[model samples]
Target: MRRPDAQAREILALAVPALGALVVEPLFLLTDTAIVGALGTDSLAGLGLASAVLSTLVGLFVVLAYGTTASVARRLGAGDRAGAIGVGLDGTWLALVAGLVVAAVGAASAPTVATVFGAAPGATDEAAVYLGISFLGIPAMLVVLAATGVLRGLQDTRTPLVVATVGFTCNALLSYLLTHGPGPLPGLGIAGSAWGTVVAQLLMATWLVALVVRGAQRYAVPLRPHARGIRLAAVAGVPLLLRTVTLRVALLVTTWVAAGTGGESLAAHQVVFTVWTFGAFALDALAIAAQALTGRNLGAGDAAGARRTTRRMVRWGIGGGVVFGVLLAAGSPWLPALFSDDGTVRAAVTAGLLVVGLTAPLAGYVFVLDGVLIGAGDGRYLAVAGLWALLGYLPLVAVVPLAGLTGTTGLVALWVAFAGGFMAARALTLGLRERSGRWLVLGSD
Candidate 1:
């Protein structure tokens, strides 16, 4: 048996690169945020709403990655490489179809989405401009997500790391040039950010497809999409989809609240949310490791292994969270400067970060356990748990009206509900589930 230290090493080997890749993935938006922030508050606020919409769609479909990882890792653990590859194949096709649908809907409803967010006039128009152009990239982004899942399930995080690095670098260069209109290219403002993302996503998608095709060939995995396998993936994925939807609804509601608070609050909330997402990548790395490890262990019929790994991952998750929380608190005063020059925006962002920082450990506990449940393929339970958590968060949602809160104070209350109330709810449910030992199903597929 691998000792605890060995387990730690194994998880880190998978997680560290994952951490890098995850953080870098968000840097694409971070790059756009910084560049557009320089254009002024209206531009930044517009990007916030548009990007929020895009992220919500992407997140809702993340079952492509999550379901694929769990299924592939399980099959591979049971010594079925072909089955693993097939999971990835189905996931890729699903992502493509899902993306196409999202693109169509988002393109048609871009203005309405922005309008619903209650952004000011300039911000709403800028949001529509960015959202319209950004829809073109959803297919590419979904492909990339599915392809990354294939490699991740195959126990190779480094390839995705390299892909993210190249993609982000290209996006930064393209967005910078297009934003400035250095040549014949007109300075497209927020629209430039969308175009740059599309260009980088196309390149990344092409590269990822090549890698996936090569894997299929090497494994002798069938090239055609299998209807049964695709349905199986969707069956496993639908519950998680609902889970993702609830999460996005929470975020969108929060964004709407921020929008109502005023332009400065909206702009600052963007920066704070970006920082939370960035810090989440650290904890998420541990969660990713948990997904792969727990699935593999359960598939191997090694319950002890899964339990041990879960304990170790929890430790790793909380440790990572503490470190990130410290960094968040320490850097909040300066990090906002990276995205905005306005004093009021910076101050609002700083206040938001403090609340998020205090709850980082709670987030860590919540994330790892959540991954463990997912890795064990308990999506149905997660679906129910998500609803319960969302409902539990509703009373806090009323804090906006009940407390007569507005502006930064309102944003702070929202984060406290988010980071404190919601995450705490998840930790409780997942923690109890883990102790119950009901999620250890294996070898049934």
Candidate 2:
């Protein structure tokens, strides 16, 4: 085999650590699910609904990460380190405010949010409890997101990888201890899991904030939030927020459909969806790399480098997806056992896993292209493209229930519409945009 090219080496340098960070990000949820799953089917299903709502809320603000990454990387590439840090600081401040507002609202309306998914009464109550406590962690979560973007843009994915690894470890230890009974520390059921995760998130956020602050001070960048800077950051994030909202809505709808199918099916779908999300984030490691590298290249006016990087990363993305798909397919028989004890739930999860495995490659393609556009600061196009993709997804999902399917068969149909139809729609839209070559604009905008 030939030696790796310079661009390939560069990509790996960023992507490898980024992979660790991204993969660990989802492990937080996966761990919580595994722990809370022991509480029984209703609890598992409830956590599913709460997780869906919480993720959607956090995901809508993903611009805190993606937007900051692009802006910081561009400025850094243009040799304005101080300016880059300033943008990241602005994002962090915005995250704090947004998180506070969302937490207050989400906590107050926990039952309303939980019931919207239509899970069983027991599951709904459990979901509400989890949601109420979990909302308190949103600020830390968003802070971590914005701060991680800063590090990634600064070409320091290793810091995030290390911090996330430690955080996940803390979450796992705490989740196990709190979720289960031990001496005086009695178990709090799903609430215990929520508290554990929140504490771990707070720790991670503290570490990240300190790091960003130190970086800002080193660059002589002001730590205080500037009105104009914060406003500009928010303005820049709106389109990305729209893009993220459409994506989140699609997921929320999927959870709603799963909820309507019955508790067993909902529980199974929850496990499978968590695994699918884990795989998605695994693939998104490459996307994160693309965001950093592409923005940097364009900021340096090296459009050719950006093009070459994109081409190379696309191949890597597909290859990574193939590996993950194979793993998902191969593990389907045994994977569900780890999450639930119900035979029906296990069977449903196995079927869902197969569907997710089949669609993994398509997801890889869609995600990388998405990162490329976002890195180019082409959020406007992305927002429109996301809408088109969501429209395609809604009709296909609608057809699932309209067909009058139920039980395992219904779950399979829903997964097909989601894994197959939704991902395919995303691929089509992103591919068109990539082929047009319009996102390769130079300089920090």
Q: Clash totals for all models, in order? A: 0, 0
- Model 1 is weakest, by summed lDDT over 10 consecutive residues, at 1-10
Candidate 1 per-residue lDDT, tens place, 136-238, comes to 8899999898888878777778889999999999999988888878778678787887899899999998999888888789989888888887788878899
lDDT of each: 0.86, 0.89
Q: Over the stretch 1-445, how does candidate 2's per-residue lDDT look in tens digits?
A: 9999888888888889998887787788889999999999999999999987777776777789999999999998888999999999998998898889888998899989899978799999999999999999999999999999999998889999999999999999988898896678679899999999999999999999999999999989999989888898889999999999888889889988988788899898888887888888778888999999989999888988888889888888888888888999999999999999999989999999999898888888888998998898999998998899899899889876787766788899999999899889888988888888888787766
* Candidate 2 clash figure, as a count: 0
Model 1 regions lying over 4 Å from their true place? 1-4, 34-46, 111-115, 118-126, 178-192, 255-272, 327-354, 405-414
lDDT of 1: 0.86
